[model samples]
Target: MTVFAAEQQFHDAEASLPSHQARLACRAGLAQTTAGVAPGYIQGNLAILPETYAAAFHRFCQLNPKPCPIIGMSDVGDPMIPSLGTDLDIRTDLPRYRVWRDGELVEEPTDITAHWRDDLVAFVIGCSFSFEEALLADDIPIRHIEQKVRVPMYRTNISCAAAGPFAGPMVVSMRPLKPKDAIRAVQITSRFPSVHGAPVHLGLPQSIGIADIDKPDYGDPVRIEPDEVPVFWACGVTPQAVIAAAKVPFAITHAPGLMLVTDLKNKHLAVL
Candidate 1:
C-alpha cells in the first residue's frame, strides 16, 4: 500500500475505536503519531519517574506551567490512573515509549510492562493535539498534519525554573502559519489553558535558541514557506528534556508525537 493509503487505514482504525481500545491497538504495534487519533479525546504526554523524584518534578511542572501543564497523575506505585481514563494502564497505552537511563535514551519500546516499578509515579501532561483540533475546526491549516508527519519540536535556550533534579531547556513545538492565521490561532488557543494555552514565540526561531528552522530537535520537520512564519508553543514534551538534563537514574516518556489516548474530551480541558 502507498503511504497515503496506509495513513488512511490508520486513521479509519483509530476513528472506529474508543480511547482504551485505540490504546490497546497501539500496544499491539500499530505505531503512528497520536495527532489525529481518537478525534475529540485529549491526548497526553507521559512521564513516569521514581517516587523519590516525583515531588520535585511536580514542583517543576508548577513552576513551568506553560510547558508542563499537568492533566492527570497516577498514585505512586500504581499503573492505572482512573481519572485520565477508565482501565488506563501506563505501561501499554501509548504507541511508543522512550526509556531513559541517566539522561540517555536506552530503549524505544512498544510496551513498558516489564519496566514497571512500585516506586514509580506516572504523570500525564496536556498535549498540543487538543488545540490543533480546535485550529482545524476553524479551518486553519496544520502543516504537519497536512503532510502526514509528526509536529516539529525543539529544545530552546529558554530555561525552566529548577526543582530538585527537574530542570532543563524549555522545549517548544512549531507550526508555520500565515500572519493573519497566527493571530487567529492565538485567539482560538487562548481558551485552552490546560493544554499550553497560546504561542510562546513566533516568527524568529533564533530568539528561542532554535538555531535551524529546518532541523528540529524532536519529531519530523515540515516546510516553512516564505509567506508563512513559524509559531512556537510550550510543549508537553518538555518533561523529557528535563529528564535528560537532570540525569535521573531512570525515567520513561512517550516517544515524541506518540501520546496516551485519554477518555477526557478536549473540550473538557478548555478554560473558556
Candidate 2:
C-alpha cells in the first residue's frame, strides 16, 4: 500500500477510540499524531522533569497560562496521574516522547519506561486538540485534520513569561479558516480556556515572525485556501521550546503532535 493509504488506515483505526483505548493503542507502540483522534476526549501535552525542576516549571506554567495551562500533574516519581485517568501511565501512554539532555533533543522514544526516573514529575498541559472538537462541532474547517496531517506550528516573536531556568519564545499552532468561520472559531474556542482557548492572532503570519506559512517549525503544513486566513493559538508545545532554551539537564516532552489522551471529556473543560 502507498504511504497515504497506510496513513488513512491508521487514522480510521484510531480516530474514534474511547480515551482508554487510545491510551492502550499508544502504549502498544502505535505512534501517530493524536490530532482528530478520540474526538470529544481531552488530550494533553506531556512534560516530565526531575523533582528539582518541577516547582520551577509549575511556576512557569502559572506565569504563562496561555501556552502552558496546567490540566493534570503527577506526583514525583509516579507515572500515574489518577486525576486525568485512573489507568493513565505517563511513562508509556503518549504515542511518542522527546527525551532531552542539556537542552538538546537526544531521542524520540515510543516508550519512556526505560528512561523513567524515581524523581521525575509529570505535567499534562491542556492541548488545542480539545478545542478542535469544539471547532468541528461548530462546523469550522480544520485544514490539518481534514488533510490527515499534523497541524502546522511555528515559534513566534512573542515571549512567554519566564520562571526559574525556563523561558523562550512562545510557539503557536495555525489553522486556516474563512473569515466567517474564523470569527465563529474564536467564539467557540474561547469557552475552553484550559485548552488554549481562542486565536492569539489571525491573518498576517509574517507579523508573528513566520515568513513562510508553508514551512512550519514543527508538524506538517496544510495549504491555506485563498479565502481563508490563518488563525494562531498559543500552543502547549511552548514548553518544549522553553526546555530547549533552558537546557535543563534532563527533560521529556510529548512529540509535537502526539499527545496524552485523557479520560476527561472535552465538555468538562468548557467554561460554559
Candidate 3:
C-alpha cells in the first residue's frame, strides 16, 4: 500500500484517541521534526546495517537493552517490520533518513531505495519520545515542544559494552523537569521497557561526562529552568555512536527527530 493509503485504514480519533491523520501527516512529510507527533503513541529511532554485521549488531542491542531496545527488526533485504505494525515498510515510513558510509554521514534523503540493498537489516529502537505521552498525561511540560525544537542529545563519557564491530560510549537525551515531576516521570516511564525505561541519572550532567549541556552533540538544545534539574536517559543515538566507532562500511538512520510512526499504540508498550 502507499504509505498514506495504508495509514488511512487505521482508526484514529483525536478526542477519544490520538489523531492517526495528524500522526500520518507528520509521517507523510508534513512535519520536519517530531517533537510532538502522536502524543500518546510510541515513536522510534531507526538504524539499518548490512547483513555482514547484522548478527553482531543484534547481539549488541540484546546486550545493551537500555540504549538499544529493539522494537522492530526486519529480515535482511526486507523493508517490513511486522512486530511494529501490520504493514510497515522501513524505507518509506520515516519522514527523513541519514545515509552513512564508513561511519560518515554522506546524505540525508527522504527515501532510501537508491541505497537499499539485498543484505541490509533494519532496526527500530524505542525512543524516549515514546514516554512523552505518559509525561504529558501526568502534566510534565516538555520544553522543546513549547519552543518547537529537537530534544537535546549529547555524547557522554559512559562507555557501552563492545560486541564484535559495535562499540562506543552511550549517548543521552536530556529533559529538564521540576524535582517532583521528575520523580513522576521516572515512575511513568519505568513501565515501557521496549522504548527506553527509567532515568539513567538525574541532577548532574558532569557526573555522566557531559561537558557542555548548552551545546548538544545532536538535536537542538532546550532551555533549562533554575528550579528544574536535567534528567538524562540512555538514547538511541548510542547505536549511531557504535556504528561510527566501528567504522561500518555503510549504514542508515533516521534524521534525529523524524521517526517511523507505527500501528502499535503507546498503551501497548506500558508495563501496567
The TM-scores of all predictions, comma-separated, are 0.90, 0.90, 0.88
What 10-residue stretch in candidate 2 is worst by lDDT?
Answer: 12-21
Least accurate 10 contiguous residues by lDDT in model 3: 11-20
Clashing pairs in 3: none
Q: Considering lDDT, which of the candidate structures 2 and 3 is the better prediction for this target? A: 2
Compute the lDDT for candidate 2: 0.90
**Runs in model 3 with CA error above 4 Å?**
1-31
Q: List the global CA lDDT of all models.
A: 0.90, 0.90, 0.83
Give the higher-TM-score candidate: 1 or 3: 1
Colliding pairs, model 2: none
After best superposition, candidate 3 residue 93: deviation in angstroms?
1.6
Model 1: how far residue 205 lies from native, Å: 1.9
Local accuracy of candidate 1 as per-residue lDDT tens digits, 1-272? 99999999899766644887788788788877776678999999899999999999999999999999999999999999989887788898889999999999999998999999999999999989999999999999999989988889999999889999788889999999999999999999999988999999999899989999889988899988999989999988888888888999999999888889999999877777
Worst 10 residues of 1 by lDDT: 12-21
